[model samples]
Target chain A: MSEVIIPNVTRDDRIGSVFNHLFRIIAESEKLEGKVLWNFQDVHFFHPFFVFPFSLYRYELSNKKNVECKGMNDVVQSYFSTIKFFDFMDLREIGDFNNVLKCYKEKSYTPICRFSLSDKNIERMQSIIKDVILQQIKLPINIESHLSYMLGEFVCNMEEHSQGKYGYIFSQYLKKEKSLYLCLADDGISIYSSYIFKEKHLDKIDEYESSALRLAKAGYSSKDRPEAENRGYGISTNSNLLVKGFGGAFFILSGGAFHREEAENNIFIELPKSIRWNGTIILMKIPLSEAKNVNLYKYMER
Target chain B: MKRNTIKLSTLLGENITSRSSLQILCNILKSNDVIDMSDIVFISRSVADELCYFEESYNIMFVGMSDFTRKMLSLVRKNRNKPRKRQEQDSKFVVCDDIETLLSVVSSI
Candidate 1:
């Protein structure tokens, strides 16, 4: 059995780097056809960042190799269980229609849930935004509007672009940090893969992920090149609002590229050679204080 | 001019973020109808973009947005009508190929 040791993604480790490291393990082990054992011995604190990526990739890994996750301590397992991480192992969904089960408002973390762009899921997510998210933050209407719009744009983009049947999301309000941590991921055609078809984007393409991320940030859409649908506004506007408007952090890792953004800094870089996310993973930290003062127009109206 | 008023908040509480859905709803209204955004606590950018198209309504007037909502909408309206440059500027990023340079550069902004 091939054993892949899961690293502790604690406060000490740079989250983006840790995530990529974990992803590197999965990407490298995909060719191994035998039983794959995931060791969680090093994990002590269970951060939500690990749940989305591992859950998404673990399922895919299971298809090619018999996957077994062990070494989870009580705390790690409990956190994972609460978020329904194990449930996804068998591809089992808690809600048949569209519900990422909720424990209570007090739990402060919404279980990872699957969604689509269907009208029903849109409504469901709206409810989640208000009840699950807004209620927790208890911000005034201004922040409420931007937060709802930001979250909706990300999810809707996934619905419209991911081309995957179900997009997954998990959000938690970290009271200590006064920030909302949200991660949206999908196992679908990645941004880099989709952009290869665009003739305008081709000449600008680099062997690295710089071109794909730049194109995405620059409002280039693989689907709507010059159409009227405002296809590319989601990533650009939302990133601007988070990093520029709210002083928050926005991150996206897809294929071989990872882009990280904040108010004063923006970095787009290629992941280690041969390390690529088959689909995409987006991790955002919405600073609660700055979000309250966020001016949606500043980012959106451009 | 026949006037019909529709409250966006009634459809989806104080926040209305969906653009295509809002456009579809606006499609059903007459050019003279009044759509109330007053009850709306927040209006998303894309939805506001669609709303800007109603400048003449060819069809309707978006009304009733709170001062904050109105301010947000007005910005979208202002930019939507402004003539945009034919050549879209390329997005700039300080891409770091190596760890030292990446560490030296700001990672995200």
Candidate 2:
């Protein structure tokens, strides 16, 4: 039996450290065999950006290998429970997820949720999420509508491209900073894998995840369909809106590559050594107050 | 020519992203057909570009657009109508099946 230690991580000023720790886990995760023990004793704080991907990972690992998670302090346990992180690991507790996120114990969050392919019911979740954001946080109508646009475009693109059965998501609104943090992780056809099927992309992107990430940033769609079908503008325009327009941070992690972008700052990309992310994970932090900084028409591709 | 009315909110919702939905509508529409875009707060750039694509085909008219929707629609239209970039036709790079093939090509260089 092998053991993996869950670290205490948060999305703070030291975000580079958070990602480095995440990469270390991915490098280690690929090696585990037989029964595995996951120790959460040191995880005093687990931000969704740091923990939601693992929630999906733990769910996937359960199907193939024996995995057990134990030892969490009250703070870690409450954060996990509030986000419904523990529910993902326990199928019996899931109960089809019909009753999840019913009570908004915390006004600022929506629990970790799985948007399954069979149901195709992201609308209900979107409604609840939008309501939570609007009611609790007083955002300008334009910001509210644009945030809705970002969610619709991002998730619709996910549904169209991923081809994976299930994707996990969670969100939170910070009152003081007036920022909204949203994340979605899917063990699906990653950008690297998606390009393999699209012969049109064969020349544009290398098979390497880094190459795929570059094309993705450059407005290349991974759809195998003809260019006339108009399949790939979602990520490009939305990233511009979030990172460039709102002065927010956008992060995408898949395969061995990771990218982070923000306005008036240098773009960050990491080709982590020996790391293999079986799927894709994205996190966006949008400053609601800065929606005025962006001229919507200016960001759209002409 | 007989004009038809197409309500965007009814076609999708207040916030629209799916462009194919409108593509389907355009097939039944004709030149001068009116698309009612009232009550629509947000439409993605892709969807706006699709509207631009439809303009070349059907030449339909979009009416009842709020200031926001109209601005986005006009921007995409103006941008698409700009002078075109000459097509390179894949002369810039080599096409391969996967990453392994790409690696082989790079190693040879």
Candidate 3:
């Protein structure tokens, strides 16, 4: 039996660091036979930041080999289980699993689960956003509208580009930090592949570096017919709202690339390369104060 | 012939998210001679772009939009045509502040 111990992956660490570590672990797991025991002995804290991307990894890995999680303390276990991370990966013997489920049922304001992106689901996500805004930051109803547009554009983009089965969205409000976190993950053709598949000019783009940054350009889209199509503005609009409008940070991980918006110039910084995110992870953090003063109408173009 | 009037916010509800809904509204704008945007509060960029496309087949005039909404529409039109701003300074999209101005503009058209 082969065993792999996962290091502590927490929000305090750079997201790239954790992803690179996971990439190495996944690469190593290929050598092991039978089920790989993924131990979390040193993992004292499991940050919500990694929840969506980790969930995607777990799903993709399950198809390749059996990976069992072990040695999780109550706090780490509860956080993972509460987000239904364990259940989605089909892991067994989750301690206090019922309690974690109870947390979601009780905290209807925050929904952490795997669901397809549809209009009904969009409303559910909007309600979660609305609740987070009201509780953490008092924002106008227009905030709900803005979040809805962003989420809708993201899901619609998934439907158009991701040739995968389902999309995942989860949101949580950090009470202490006075910030709201929203994450959307999908396991499908990533931004790089989508562009390469559709665009003619950049058929030979370096998957590791170029594809991720080009995704931020406003007019650029993966759709085949740009003149006849009103597509390709989803990611740009979301990025605009996050970095330029609300003055928050936007992070996108796709196709072996990590892109973060520079607060100074609003330009995307291509961080060090790691393992490719099979699909894509859109993680956003907006401060409470910014939410209250955000001008959705002013920020968004017609 | 009386120009057609459509309240975007009323037709699509206070917060519009569905792209198809905008398409349906665009259909109404096309079937009519002229469409007015009197009660629109906010429009997503995608939806705004779609409306811009509809302008090719329909005479679109925006009226009664708040400063925020008007600014968004103006920006969307400009951004949509950012590559051809110099050539197309006279964008087909017209925005009137009040119904009186909208009537006068519509009468001229």
Q: Which stretches of model 2 miss by more than 4 angstroms?
A: A14-17, A88-102, A117-127, A139-142, A222-232, A263-274, B20-33, B81-109
Q: How are the candidates ranked when ordered by lDDT, highest leading? A: 1, 2, 3
Q: What would the TM-score be for candidate 2 when compared with the true structure?
A: 0.79
At residue A72, what lDDT does model 2 achieve?
79
What local lDDT does model 3 show for residue B17?
A: 49
Question: Which DockQ-derived CAPRI band holds candidate 1?
Answer: acceptable
Please report, in order, the local distance difference test score of every candidate based on alpha carbons. Answer: 0.66, 0.64, 0.58
Winner by TM-score between candidate 3 and candidate 2: 2
Best by lDDT: 1
Error of 2 at A167 (Å): 3.6
Candidate with best DockQ: 1
For each model in turn, which proportion of the native inter-chain contacts is also found?
0.16, 0.12, 0.11
What digit string (tens of lDDT, one per residue) describes model 2 on residues B1-109? Answer: 6787888687666766555446556657777777888888777666787777676777778888888788877766765544432222111233434434433432332
> lDDT value for candidate 2?
0.64
Model 2 per-residue lDDT at A174: 80
Worst 10 residues of 3 chain A by lDDT: A89-98
Candidates 2 and 3 compared by DockQ, better number: 2
TM-score of chain A of 3: 0.78
